[model samples]
Target: MSTNTEARLFSPTTIGAIGVVNRVAMAPLTRSRADMEGVHSELAIEYYRQRATAWLIISEATNISREGRGYAFTPGIYTDEHVASWRRITDAVHEAGGKIVCQLWHVGRMSHVSLQENGAAPVAPSAIQADEQVFLESQTVERPSMPRALETAEIQRLVEDYRNAARRAMEAGFDGVEVHAANCYLLEQFIRDSTNKRTDQYGGPVENRTRLPIEVITAVAEVWGADRVGVRLSPITRAVGDTPLDSDPEGTYFYLAGQLGKLGLAYLHCVEGQTRGDNGAGDFDFKRLHAKFGGKYIANNSYDRQMAIDAAESGHADMVAFGRPFISNPDLVARLRLDAPLAEANRDTFYGGGAGGYTDYLPLADAA
Candidate 1:
């Protein structure tokens, strides 16, 4: 076990304008504990507060607008009421001496009509259906409804939704925001050529295909200076609905990272491989992608303690993000420093639930 002074993971680092106490970050995990109105429940305050030891907490995938939702009980950031609800959670995290950022999300075609407004079809870059399923209000999984191609004119409105969500994140007292452009979501739908078959400015070649995501990021950067914003990307993840990899994962993502780097954003959070699976699932070079960006990198996806320590010591990553571990070990930073055994989280209680597996897990000290 490495002492606090021995582990480079305990060292402080600056992610853009935000100075973190350590290189450990809590990746976004969808708990589906929000109310029907998309407001986070009161239990979330303690849930996040318990994990305050992390250098940064990237909030779960949050909806930017009503049309952005794909799963039930996920939080939204569009309404004033939503802002007020999130403010309390942010206050709790801050009071506990933690920094957090909201992850703006739009599920695109990965939605069911039952979860949509007026049973409307979900919108996507093309009118194609995904091979995935979404969780409905009843906690049952159902196939996604067919989607309609987004009109070129509506593209600007989607950008506006992201901009407005960033504005609301500011109002809610978050330290910063992460644009969720990964995992076959709305942004990724437009980014990958497999799903996007449009002939408009947002389709075809790599340049045109990445237009919408770049524009959305630009709009978000306009609200919170580029230095305070971060973009999350998964170059070859087929996690949701078996979304196929881009025709050229290396070419597409390297180009995208270079473009984002030019915007002077804080950092690029890359899911190294499959979301909850393999870390070396593909042949793409993440180091080259990081080099292409020429900025700080937060390496994620199944990173264990030694891997994280090595990444930090070798300067391969500025920070490392842990997902499921954070759910079972709120004092994960302390455990890592002491080399303590981590508790496993209950898979059944991972989704919509009360305070069972959410916050009942004891810290190392309490467990001892």
Candidate 2:
């Protein structure tokens, strides 16, 4: 590729009010390295500081409350200790000249009994059990236990939890937050009819199904402002416990894009497939979604240097987020700029480990 072509990926852009020097954004990846208390250790600060060259970095999916946790050692943003720990992380990233956003998550029915308080069932939009297993530091369940359906009033409270978490994120010194409404989590469970069989105002039709996500997004946007808030959506992903497809995937998500556009959020981040390159969900019409959103469009899942460059240069995306690639290539931007060979990430130490595969990845200068 020519210099001008590659320069498109390196060009500066603004997502809402935040000014970024390039369109390369780091996608959130779960490393599960936090302490049992949900306090991130110094290792996390080093891990993020290593990848601070990305124009923007989205932190791992962080629980907003104890009830939201589905995996062990994942970080949370609810307590004072958690806030203080995360402040160090955000400060380090900022000091390294990078912008980082926290991804707020609630795992919903994707929980095992061990993860729940007092052995209580996990909460979800409905009582459906995902055909998936939950992995903890000590054990793994064959399949997730059935979850308790959330009462209408309980959902109201959960929305408030999101708002409070956003406040906590700001207190922790994060640049912004991305609501994890994707991957069969609490919000996505409500949006899909197969999971939400309720007859009340929060189920049945598309309007009812989408109500929870809109309310949650609106609540978070209120705390952080819409310009500083983003939402991640998986329109056709079934990888996370085979989260059933929406009856009308097109209608459901198109309407969601339109509704999100009205909120004037900073951007809409979409995971294009299962993992990065496997489009297991098949083809999607990005143009329609772009038109519906009418805001910044961030494309994720399996983008290479050329693919990202093409997407930005061709006007298909306003930003591109790289996941696993950023794991091993802390200087991913520099490597792509020079067309250098990349490092391979070790699968064994991808999660819940020390600095082996986490912060040990050397930058290009060090390797050379």
Candidate 3:
């Protein structure tokens, strides 16, 4: 086990059933490029195939059902058509020697009424309105709609929905599925004390707050097996639609990570440091989580090539996930290895766009 920079960053490793040639991963990114029918296009196939060099590529946060949709043109995995559409993308990645996993998501209170069913209210652990607005095809609106508190029965159904979606993902040819428990979505909304004010067994104490997420994980694991599953958590980020930081983030996530560890997950993706800037947000120690998690850590958020090398060489993370870099640099893994200049990503075309900024970025040779 050489601890040199290249050795640490490029060494092959196994994460559960998936094998990686390097420690570079592609973080799940929402581009809102799916069709109106919630199906991925051929463009998505090429988009993923171009970035196939990543050790693992986590697909964008995909809705599990119509009720789970929070933004326009985001793909879903709950329908037969959706499964078929995703097969093309998965087949392309596999053909290009890549491993990919779909991220199961439910927006919960972070949704707007326009994206809901028949202008219905979104659902959450409680009826609290998130201080966040959702993105629409037309425009980004403010003042997210007030969500209805999910009944105990509906909560059970949501867990079942996750199971079904995982099954569909496997059918769609994904290597596995990653539970979207981070980024102030449905699971995070329940895990955080500030949003979950329920008096039932699914709220109040940390155990209660963690209940829904655990159930969802268990159901998804039952479908994909624990070894093929991964969980993502953002312990300190509060920028997703003004999601508030937890009063006891350290305690809440440590306990959660320890619990997830018991399930034998493939990896735990932790979004640490500042959301958009450097890794100097606060006193939060992601290394402590790596220890408690007792599994491979995929560290994400604002990581450069050197920072990624440092995290792996120091045993802080087994892999580093890059989002924005992958957007502009299709050959990101090669570029990082050679320390080549990365192409600048056009933020304007990041979401709700066509291939102008999606698959149009040239590789190193073309750029040269």
Note each model's CA RMSD in angstroms: 1.3, 1.5, 1.6
Candidate 1 lDDT tens digits, 1-101: 34454787898989999999999999999999999789988899999999988969999999999999999999999999999999999999999998999
Per-residue lDDT over 1-368 for candidate 3, one digit per residue giving the tens place of the 0 to 100 score? 44344568888888888898898999999999997568998899999999999959999999998889888899999999999999999999999998999999999888888888788999998888888567875756667789999998788889888999999999999999899999898999999998898999999999999999999998999998888899999998887868888899999999999999998999999888656666652569788888899998899998888888888888888899999999999999999888889999999999887899999999999999
lDDT of each: 0.93, 0.88, 0.89
Name the lDDT value of residue 125 in candidate 2: 83
The sequence of per-residue lDDT tens digits that candidate 2 reaches over residues 146-259 is: 899998878889998999899999999999999998888889999998799988899999999999999999999999999999999988787787788888878998999999
Off by over 4 Å in 3: 1-5
Ranking of candidates on lDDT, top first? 1, 3, 2
Clashes of each: 0, 2, 0
Model 3 residue 359 CA deviation in Å = 0.6
The better candidate by lDDT, 1 or 3, is 1
Which window of 10 residues has the lowest lDDT sum in candidate 3?
273-282
The predicted structure with the larger lDDT, 2 or 3, is: 3
lDDT of 2 at 121: 89
